[model samples]
Target: MSYLQKGNSMIRRTTAAKGLALAAVLSLGLTACASSDDGSGDSTEGGGGSSEPLKIGTILPVTGTLAFLGPPEIAGVGLAIDDINAAGGVLGNDVTVEWGDSGDSTDLSVASSTATDLIGKGVSVAIGAASSAVSLGVVDQFAEASVMQISPANTAADLSGYGEFFARTAPPDTVQGPAHADLIMGDGHCKVGFLVQNEAYGNGLRDYIQEALEAGGCEAVYGGNGEGHEFAPGETNFGAQVTDLLAQKPDAISIVAFEETTAIVNELVSQGWDFNGTTYFVDGNLSNYGEDFDPGTLEGVQGTLPGAQADEAFRDQLTTWYSENESGELEDFSYSAESYDATVLAALAAVKGEATDGATISQNIRAVSGAEGGTEVKTFEEGVKALEAGDEIHYVGKSGIGPLNESNDPTSAFIGIYKYGADNTYTFERQIEGKIEE
Candidate 1:
């Protein structure tokens, strides 16, 4: 069945001066030498005609608060590269990747420097910046350099139509937020409180969920956008925030911070607050806390994560690949499937356009995603074969997301609901499918 739903009823942050100067110089240089063809994806256009080797780059988190997401995401990229090369690579030349770090928003230097390095490397496609704030910090650099930036785990709603050069495999908060609100309301909670991180990801998601909650006749008693319960990034202390939220006498509370979730959880326990089934988590904090929290501490807690639940076959592939290549065990598999799809989609776009440059890839990305209707192929090899036979291919990747819409967000996606077990690890409960409103 097609994943699409009919009718779709559904940031530049400041950086150092050095990065800005470099990006400005690069943008001017590229514009000066740009081809007359307007990157319209026509075969006769100026940029989509090259057959050079596709060089991919990454700006994923290898350090900082969101570091837990790094393993699965990096593994996903490596696995895609392996598959692409094994299938004889793109345009008969082996694909290459330059790995870099996009540390969380706590330190802007990491993302800025890394983005500069990737853009300078002349990579055709850059694959990350997991945190929404981090991505916002460096998107202009990639956009200015005419490099396509595909993020596997950025979900801020404001990023929609940010530019022609930016795209993401993950559905925006527009899908996840309302879905999360439904989860809270479905369980009969009427008064909800949010202890959100005051950043792009947290603020945007808080707004959407709050809107849904109010629409459902539920009251957002505390932490409704700009109501002062929001915490800053790297905030290790949440005692006051918790105190403030509980004072609102809320029936449910959603914790929407990154690494700060641990501190918040601990504070909740200290306050003698009975969370269990009444507490909630979003994608940024839906982690396995078996080692962090005591047994049964989070037994009845539930959380929401974007993307469909991956099948066992794909899980095994990620597991096997990580074991053979990386050092530690793969723990949180939150965005692994999306990460794989991001890399594969970009590579497929390169193949479909018969070029490895960013402009060409951007033009063909939506087309290869089956936006115009085409044959469905699951694997990279199958997609290549189908494209070779003069067929427009729809890549049915493991993420189970529908084609990219006009905003470059997935037309439809699944938000997996998870419940914490006695071991403090979350297990899949069920998934809610949501269509992004076009």
Candidate 2:
């Protein structure tokens, strides 16, 4: 297939952008306005005969409920940027980057403003806003602006076909949902009560878990979407929800939530529920709860998240780098590798297409992603060598996401099971493997 000619491509992209913009204006009736706190004011860089360098904007949640996730995600981005620049950046100019925060879906104002600001600054590619629903809220804006968007920790299946410009390293929750149910059932918890946040991530995972639990002969006792038990966003005070779940008297409870996990657990304890029974958790609230819970508060609890255990050596390296760049230490490494891989993939795509424009980058992403007929290269510098030698290169990163599926999602990933200790911190249990059958 022949690539679009530069002139013709410009016309098509402009027309597409205009149409998408019009559609956006007509459909977006959201009243809440977002404000971006961390973002760059750099000039746009792309195929418009501009000499400005390639610019990327990181929009992961740098604050709010998911703040525990910020460290490793930012570490992944920072490390990739350093590696790419050291290898002689895309199209001869060092890539420039801007940082922004996406609080959560509850507050669309933050991510919405961040996306608008990043698009205005001419960012060729945008990464993040970890929440699946949060990403959904503003993805069209990036798509219309012609900015390639990559998310590192979004797993909602609803976003599977969000747009041609959207890509995510995280596998949809369907892959891990069964693992969660199987683990709970296998542990002999025949009856289960589920407490979910009632959003994309929570509800989607809940559907799969319910099916698996029933299939395994376990009963889904309570808590489902619109069941009057589903927690509303920012609806704090889980007192009522806990009281309701206890009424079901299930042997086990499965919780998929964000920061609310801590509050929910506190409620459970206050109401005479013990963690001694099997209590399963999902990615959102799997962080260290030591500050809030007493020793042994979560001692036998289990949780699961997508992604294999990061290699020990790599974890040490990332920790050192993270501490130097941002703050204390790398505590939760949930999507760290995926974040690194997403950034690197975007950068390599920019190089392969020889343009920083969103459309151009998206067009060439496969060439650097172990596509058919491409020579494999493991590092950015190595891929650069292959490019210099006039060879198409397939670049693989630390995440091991090989190539993307037709949906622009990772072809392979792992679901890691974790067990909590006396200190309310989790330790790796086992990894469930996944791959697209086709």
TM-score per prediction, in order, is 0.90, 0.86
Which candidate comes out best when scored by TM-score? 1
lDDT of 1 by residue, 389-420 (tens): 98888998889999998888889899999999
Name the lDDT value of residue 38 in candidate 2: 19
Query: What are the RMSD figures for all models against the true structure?
Result: 7.6, 9.0
TM-score of candidate 1 relative to the true fold = 0.90
The lDDT per prediction is 0.83, 0.75
TM-score of 2: 0.86
Task: Please list the residue runs of candidate 1 whose C-alpha ends up more than 4 Å from where it truly belongs after superposition.
Answer: 1-49
Q: Per-residue lDDT for 318-381 in model 2, tens only?
A: 7876776564778878888888888888877766666666776677676677764477887888
lDDT of 1 at 377: 94
Q: Which stretches of candidate 2 lie over 4 Å from their true place?
A: 1-51
